[model samples]
Target: MQAAAPDLWHHYGRTRADTDRGVPDFFPWIWAQDGGPGSEVLGDVTGLVLADLGAGAARHAAHLVVHHAPARVDAIDASAAQHAMAGDLYGHLAPRLRTLHANAAEHLEAHPDEYDVLYSVFGGLDFADPRRLLPAAARALRPGGLLAAATLGHYLGGAPAEPDVQHADIPARTPDGTPATMRRWVLQEHVWTKLLDEAGFTAIGVDRLPPATSGARSADTLLLRARRHK
Candidate 1:
């Protein structure tokens, strides 16, 4: 058997996790994470079973559990480091907030029709292949369940988003600091809409959220919302 691949996300959000352990008070869907539509986009998750795909440190998931009163929120991240960080930060929320270690697509596939709401904040929807992840998401959500995700409207360096389904080899670093790369999908709005439609989602909507401030790394965010067919 071959050796396991390095965890490319091991270093992500490490610095912030060390200092800020409190659940977030707001949920921003924009690339800046400074401001924009809040959790209202998920539309009253109270008493709903939800999951945050690729939920990093699960700050947003914790916020929903604490403020929005979701019956339960599964914070799923494939990265061991991210999963561990989420557990360490918000495990106290227990019963209501569960930190899960699993790939977004695989997890959704394993639990069909298990959620009332599924969401991602520049998380799984950006890093995973929509052809697979979107269908799994549709299957995982009960009929009429909501799917919300925030993704890039364009590439980080001001490049235009792909008009077709494609993946970019973005730079990353392994746990040992070795240079590596990861696949990220930055498709145009129409492309995403088409994928969602084909994946058995209905009432699909994509909203563009401009960056709060202009900068070299700044890019617009596309807030995607859809409903599983009833």
Candidate 2:
């Protein structure tokens, strides 16, 4: 029931504890691109149920526990490879973090109105079809819920694109030790915000951060926050 292809996350989860150098902070929530903008300021999450969709390597979700003290954090990802990375990073926090290997969309369908905050860091939210994800996310959130997510901003041009069929990139490596590439769905600003509105969220805000330049090209990202109006 996975929306993304199985091969997309294979190489990413390959590192073991010995072979690993160190798991760098990918999403700190401390305002770094690697981490998030820090959960304490994100919303009222402490002592509340929270889910981190697309919790690659489980950094952000783990951070929630160590820094913010959420009662429980479900770090869900569809790729076992991704979970492997999570296992390495979590060390002894496996039970506390509750990392799960299942298609995020499928998991959400079974648990309704269960989360106070549902967040993603360029995970299933940006890669899978929003038609399937946003509605499910709305269902997972209780009334007056919040979705704090980070996703890809407009890439080439700010044109509306279909949600079901799109492509995105994952940090993949070939067996020969070269960068591998894959594409999944990435929504234009209007397309994504509208989907949230249709899914029953309101006051949706997408905050665009400064672009990162590599020689000539620039990478743009957006931090989105939406509330489920009960």
The RMSD of every model to the true structure, in order and in angstroms, is 0.6, 4.4
Native-referenced Cα lDDT, model 2? 0.72
Per-residue lDDT tens digits of candidate 1, residues 58-106?
A: 9999999999988999999999999999999999999899999999999
TM-score for candidate 2, residues paired by index: 0.79
The numbered model that scores best in TM-score is 1
**Per-residue lDDT for 81 in model 1?**
95
Error of 2 at 125 (Å): 1.1
Q: What global local distance difference test value does model 1 have?
A: 0.96
Top-scoring candidate (lDDT): 1
Error of 2 at 141 (Å): 0.7
